[model samples]
Target: MKYYSTNAKAPLATLHEAVVKGLASDSGLYMPEYLYKLSADFFDSIQNLPFNEIAKIVATAFFGEDVEQKALDEIVDDTLQFDCPVVEVSDNIYSLELFHGPTLAFKDVGGRFMARLLQYFIRKEGKEEVNVLVATSGDTGSAVANGFLGVDGIHVYVLYPKGKVSKIQESQFTTLGKNITAIEVNGVFDDCQALVKKAFMDEELNRHMKLTSANSINVARFLPQSFYYFNAYARMKAAGKADNLVVCVPSGNFGNITAGLFGREMGLPIKRFIAANNANDVFFKYLQTGKYTPMASIQTIANAMDVGNPSNFARVYDMFDGDLQKIRSVVSGATYSDEQIRETMKSCFDSNGYILDPHGACGYRALEEGLTDGETGVFLETAHPAKFKETVESAIGAEVEIPERLAAFMRGEKKSVEMSADFDSFKNFLMTR
Candidate 1:
């Protein structure tokens, strides 16, 4: 399938090109030219299908024509070796636990899928050493780093804001010595993201080193995230709780929610979406006043949702055909303060005995406030609570035993290049190295 840029200036690109090029030449995010809707029969059988089986069906819609079914299925299977089960937290709200992966974050699915798909294209095209430039608030760095770790022909550079990421989150990327390099930027998440974008658009740097983004601006990373939404719907369908189902996503750069919106376009039977926000509430403010405004990000316990100027807002705008009213009708917005997130996290633990990472707390709270009677809600518990060890422990006043996976990460010494957020410093670092 062909893809078009949200900016509407770049020529349409094939799926492979969109995956490799990441951001369009016009500095716009790439979107599919057409959304392939699933058949009624597929939804009818969705309840019985395994996670990878259902993932293959959905992945085929965007990638089947471009990739052979066998190869595509293998990619889907490899990407989804872990489970994403929906657990009932209450009578009306269910938590789609997505942290059962190597990185203990929901971005693992997208990161792994993108890694395999990009590697396939690299081998097919006989390209040499494509450097992946990714900026993470918290989880994206670890997810992308671990997903692409030791994969041939691709080197990943994870740029994250210094001191903003959790200790385990930073360790997951920084500890891996080969093929993954972590750059600690002395700024916020947006600054790190800006450095990635500037490097992509830099003519001199592009000539010296082949660069692409693993951020959600890349079609490969964001589109594969739609898998969880389908899986969530299928599970809900099986339980006969699909009626008036609302899916709540913790929003940051808006990539995750944008992918869910794609699932809705493909007839996923979702009633609506709730874009949950932390301190960086640009989208929430937009939903309130119907005006788009961006500012600096504020630090919150839910660090992953701290994007002031989300890169993928353009994609969501394009997805609904630039119709604000149409967008508002299908999706709702809610914001939570650090205090509210803490309260929700503590309350859920006290009530349901379920631990929530700060990001998941925002999602769960949004559903609690927004969902009406008879409307069952599924909030995405985006990561394992132990990933945010200190914050979660402080909120709940309980010691969380570190899992073996996280303990392994914590044991390694940190190794990261420190840099200012300036593009010149970033560009010079890339050009020199």
Candidate 2:
């Protein structure tokens, strides 16, 4: 399967090349030149298969012969060591709990899989080493840092918005040493993402360091994320509840929702995808008005989705052949304010006895507002509520227990370098690292 840039200027590339190059020379997100739709039989075959087997089928569609089935199985087995539990929060409304991984966020699945896939590609090409440059609003940094930490031939540098991420989220990336390094940008998530994109486009930097990305902009990150959509569907099928289902995803950079669309293309029986976003909802506005205008990101409790202009919009637009009407038909976008998010959290707890973080609350709100009757919707609990304990507890009037894994992290020392969002500062830091 060859991939082409959405900008239509760069040459088509195989999956490995797309993974390695990340952003195309034209500064466009890499999309498959052709998408092979899965047949009904293909979906039925994996309905009862193990997670690893299902992952192989889903992954091989994009990876093709570049990655062997055995290799893909190992990568899946290693990456998905935890469960993505689907719990019923209310009647016909379920929460896909995706925070059971090392980083306690949904990005762990993609981050870990991308790290392993990159390792495989580097080995196949006989490359000595590669450096992964990632930008995170909150979860991606820790997920990338932990996933590639201590890998033999890869080093990860994570850039995050300073004073924007949660304390635990910050500690998760900054505390890890060895192959992982964290740089705090004195700006929003967009600034950090812009710097990373600029670095990838910088030919001089490419000569000095083989720059790869673990951001959602990377095809590697997007492909592995498609697996969980199938995983959730399979689980629903086993319980005799699989039908036209809606997935409510908390949109940040829009990569998560785009991957869900890929799964839908690969024969997943999804009715519609709801792009749940915070106050800075560029996609929401674009879906409503058919006009795309990016503004500066606004601060919100759901800081991850605080992207004013998501970098993954290029991929989303490309998926629909740049047709705004086609995108609007399949996707229903909604944005929630901080006050609305808190109210949604309170209502969900008071009504269903379930706890939700701000991001999950945004998804829940979208589902409550936009869900059609008889349509089953699953809101993605992207992060554990305990990750935002202060907010969750204050809203619900109760204390949430921290997971044992996160407890260990609270005691670790944090080590991160603070820098301005200037290219020179980032470049100088990379040179020293």
Taking all chains together, each candidate's TM-score versus the true structure is 0.99, 0.98
Give Cα-based local distance difference scores for all models. Answer: 0.92, 0.88
* Model 1 Cα shift for residue 50 (angstroms): 0.3
lDDT for each residue of candidate 2 in 1-433, tens digit (9 for 90 to 100): 7889988999998888899999999998999876668778867766687766777778778776678878887898999898888898888888999998998999999999999999998888899689999999999998889989888899888999999999988888898899988888999998999999999888878888899899999999977898888888888887766787999999989899989998887678899999998899888889888899999999899988889999888888888888998898789888888889989999999999999999999988888887777788888999999988898888888789999888888878989889999998898777765
Off by over 4 Å in 1: none
| Candidate 2: 10-residue stretch with minimal lDDT | 44-53
For model 2, the local distance difference test gives: 0.88
TM-score between candidate 2 and the true structure: 0.98
RMSD, candidate 1, Å = 0.8
What tens digits encode model 1's per-residue C-alpha lDDT throughout 128-242? 8999999999999999999999899999999999999999899999999899989999999999999989887888898998888999889999999999999999899899999
